[model samples]
Target: MTGLRVLITNITLAGRTGTEIVVRDLALGLARAGDRPMVYAPRSGPIADALRRAGIPVVNDIAAVPATPDVIHGHHVIQTAVALARYPQVPAVFVCHDREAWHDTPPRLPGVRAWATVSDSFRTRVAADTGLAPEAVQLVLNGVDTDRFQPGPALPPRPRRALAFAKNQGHLDGIRTACARRDISLDVVGAAVGRIVDAPEALLPAYDLVFASALTAIESLACLRAVVVCDGRGLAGMADLPTYEALRHGNFGVGTFTGPVTAGAVGAAIDRYDPVMAVAVGQRLRAEAGLTAWTDRWRAVYAGILASPAGPEDSEARNLALAVHLQTWDPAVAPSSWTAERASLIRTLARLGSGLEPLDPGVSVAATDGDRLALTGFHTPEAWGVWSAQPTCSLRFRPATAFGPGRIRLRLAPFLPAGSPDARLTVTLNGQPLGELSFPGADGAEPRDVWFAVDALDGVTDAWLGFHSTPCRSPVSLGLSADGRRLGFSLIEVAIEPD
Candidate 1:
């Protein structure tokens, strides 16, 4: 299938994470199979650079994508939305690489001819969550480049070196302690290690053992290293034949590991390492998870989608627009509520202007649904912060009762290092300035309140809080810190007093 244009979209291709690595390798595979694959992302990083060097086309903006492609493959919700909106005619495929809850109910977009997940478990879960038939969702297991990760002359075992490579730092200390106690020299890699290596997989032959999960675990096994599946959650023990089978169905136990990741537990897993088993694991992975076989599966998938009927150009457009709007629009303040007709969505967007605004004074429109406010931005359970270079987040609230003239105050703290002068922020409410905010020039401090007074709130019931802050000086260059996160501030709470 020469000149089959395959457009792969992702949030970004700047890091060496599992998803990024997969996207890069898939593009390479497509190119090798006589297909033209162009990667579309909003941001670029080392991975993007590497793909370009491999002769794959990479565009940072969807608008810049040349002509219409045969198929659009998106890796995230935002990417799917962009594909649906920008290329309604193209058949689309959504790839579920992570186990995020948000992905379960993906953007109800049009032209999504099929869906693919990295594991069988997700294939079932995603099919149920997205309302697709079980057969509609395909299991596209992650693959490794055997040419680069193949077994080599095993390094000497005198020093007992184990490479700890992971983006998640949750169980890092426990793994480190375990390696220290066992007299194993642990060479940690990945972004969480405060540095990012270009091709860490190629270095796997230098180690006797590797602590990783998902693609990394598979790669290590392919590289003839004793593998342990551990990440932020905990440990999934050593990967023997039984565990390997179990891990395969769970994407190498990416989010399925349920055990505690203690030093002793990790040490025990390390103790089970046998050089003979490592060699066998490598051979098995080479035969099963090699790039050629993986690429053939993708090729078949692409061919199937292309051969199918032309998808409805307007299919799921309304639902997708609604999902995208609710993430940022404050219905209490917008022209229309959630139940408003689709005709009203266009009018509401014009009234809201994609900016947070406080509701106007009118008949007391007490919200019966909920009184809590919803915040929009990237946040993990462990910490909350803006994870964008130029971070701007909007807070939507629905008061239980009609709001009278009152004051709105916000409590927020910077998630920056001590003495970061660049943490200054400008606050706004519906485009109205609420003055600048400055946090304590230190980390680990309680958030302070900043108040905004309104002239009239006679019947105001819904409000929005907007924040803007400085962008990261070097988003792509933040290596070893392994976090390409562009953070602004961590919001604590919001208080509205009816006067």
Candidate 2:
């Protein structure tokens, strides 16, 4: 096994997302076990740089690979399709990490001798999508590098600091409100908040509790943090001894998020946190979900596939399936040129186009009607209005009448602390600067109309209006309260009036 060559394929090595991290850990772990592991990703970034430094070869071009591998461990369908096509005789095992993501769709190809999934939910999904028998789809639960994510110092009797470690920040508002009520400081670190950390293991030890799902939850548990299995979808409550096995079976993911995500619900879940129980659960996870044991499972899968490789008679079927997959999902480009970010941008643009509506000149557009308009970077709507969650927010509109010089008025309340300076809000229309507004600290929570005069409306068919405000501050940082969200302003309404 010391000279066993393994080629791992993934969509992108640009970020520390779930799949990307998994590929990194698996490659490193296999190499540590004396196997030669190399990675092939179309898009490369910091992760690829790190792998190269570790003596593992990461290639963007298939022809650059020095030698063929004994087994191909494929992740995303696009890269897997490319690898399988290039190495038609190679035995490969495809692993599905997500149930709904398009890239996680299992490919039907001749070189693919085995199908696997990271969770029970995705096991069923991959089986259904690939038309494989449920028994045929192997369940390979996600694992954490226990050596890297070892437990830190002992936790306090009560949690003083908590973390929401998820890429999807859907549960943040509720988690923030709940943590505030408990007098606990909350911090967020994920792509959703633009706070991605390459080494989360270094950060997880400082928090007494962590709110995450799937692989993140397992990593947190291994770090001896009280884990709450929740994400953008909903809440699954705290992971305790009573519910540990059930949640573990579900991969501590969406399958366990059966409860609604609200301040009250999240607060109730927070109340169940037990530092002692956290230690126990973490010990169990470290034993059961350690990377060494997980790598052994993968090695076994590779050996099994190598022993009984699928026949090459399904080439026509495989080609037809690949063609249908490409046409139905992305027909304009080849798999080698595709990236996850590009796909997301296209989907977002399509949604924005479909959501646009005719904007009346004199009528005010209320924040409550956000669903009817194209919007981004705003939180869930409240009775009064919607709060801009990020430093920048944007909206799209299409005026009903001919465009001309006009003033765009917005009724927004700045989140200024008692002694802080005035908050500056800069406006832009169709990428052109419109105007800037300065709101004094005394503006308070009362909404005031701020107008931005525009010279012209060039893109009258679909005008994109943007707001870039000064950096946001949290109530906890201001020592006013316990809320942890970086507050900007509450946008109540927007109206356009021709000059």
Candidate 3:
């Protein structure tokens, strides 16, 4: 498969949890496969920075660059739903992490060129809702990162504490009662229970029986405990004999993954929930599945997209395919529920690449009109390679967005870079460097919710969030999380903030 200029859009990488984990894993997988993965986030926080660190290209805006994508992959419903407003071409795939997320889709949606679901069951349900053929929807499958979630010692030694944090919190009641009968403890964590059964995930080890009923279960397993998972049945046979079989073969038993769930099926699962044996079983399954193999599959997916024809809603004439909302540029246009919206905006901007550049071509700014930066180049993997050599390019932006509390955002090029970088920020209130502030990158794209505290803006009309070059090459790399990388060397914003 040839290289593809793919566009990856999503809600936010603001937190260190569920959807974010999947995003990181996917980005990492794409990156490792020799494809350029540009991450366009609407909002960002610590999570966004983490993604940059892992060598993924990140940007804030979409209109900055002129490069068109060979394919577009939306990580979530929001991503696909929103992209319809921007792109004329149909997407290669809309990755639905949760079927329930479709309920939030905008009406009369333009169907993706392809559909992806994390679970086969969810895929069937989505097909019914979309009125599309069941076979049309593909099961991309949400895989567990075995490296992050290896099985630990077997039962007796492994605790029986269970969790159903995000997607699986609904199964706590039945699982708890079953644990009681089995003489094992069950501890549930996450925001679903609210004030009633609130428990920090940090205290998960207090219980012996670990029952994972949702995405949170993966985190529990990551803790290296004996766990049973309910996939289909009420118990989904999460603690069935297979878990025991697995434990007997492995060193320390972890637990088992259930087939699915059934009604009123707690007592039986608890009786059979074997942590030690389950761990072994999960390991074997993972080995058979082979994460490296999974990564290879993702590589194929990327390569296939790169070599495919222009997607729907896309014109075959030009090399440039990816486009975005250039007029309405603000965090307000994003999902208000997330904090990484702004980061996403800026990160996408930095990733804007030249259109249809050769496999080994390069890119440099040909012209700039006010806030609109005109890029002159083709959209190809070679452009990506050249950009990756330097990852980022920052300009002292004109304070067109008002020197207020908002970010000076723009459109970025492609999204294929290695990692985010630590930056050295120096705020200037009237051309004076107010000491120095250093911002750090993270493991993957953990949106940086950086609050750039500029020194007294009292009576000051303009301010400059000083940005000096560092390692991160993201177009949205406001040298400082609280600053900007554009503008004339002259009139600087007298912006003094504790970056």
lDDT of 1 at 320: 68
**Per-residue lDDT over 1-499 for candidate 3, one digit per residue giving the tens place of the 0 to 100 score:** 5355566777776665556666676666666666666667777666567768886766656653236665667765556545555565534566665433332232224435556565443443456455665566665544455665544444464344554443334356556666666565554444545522322334444445565544444444444454555522123345334443332221111112221232235555555555665555555556533346655655565555445664444253222322222212334655432334345446545643421111111122222121222111111112212111111112222222223333222112222113545544443333344344444544233222233333443433222223333434444542111111121111111121222
Q: Residues 1-499, candidate 2: write the lDDT tens digits.
A: 4678999999999987888889988988998899999899998999899889999999999888778988899999888888877787788999988755678878777678899988765664576577665667899888889989989789999899999975765678889999999999999988889888888889999999899988899999999999888986567789999989878877887655544456877888889988899999999989998989999999999889988936657667877866765675564555422455466557556765433445675434454354344554554455667666555566666676666687888887777667676667778776567887776765265788878777666644556667787533422211121233345777777778888
Best by TM-score: 2
Q: What pairs collide in candidate 1?
A: 14-45, 191-482, 194-480, 194-481, 195-480
C-alpha RMSD by candidate, in order: 18.5, 16.5, 23.9
**Clashing pairs counted in every model:** 5, 0, 122
Candidate number of the best lDDT = 2
Cα error of candidate 1 at position 142, Å = 0.3
User: How does each model score on lDDT?
Assistant: 0.67, 0.77, 0.43
TM-score of each candidate? Answer: 0.63, 0.67, 0.50
Cα lDDT for residue 468, model 3?
Answer: 34
For candidate 3, which ten residues in a row score worst on lDDT? 374-383
Q: Rank the candidates by lDDT, best first.
A: 2, 1, 3
TM-score of 2: 0.67
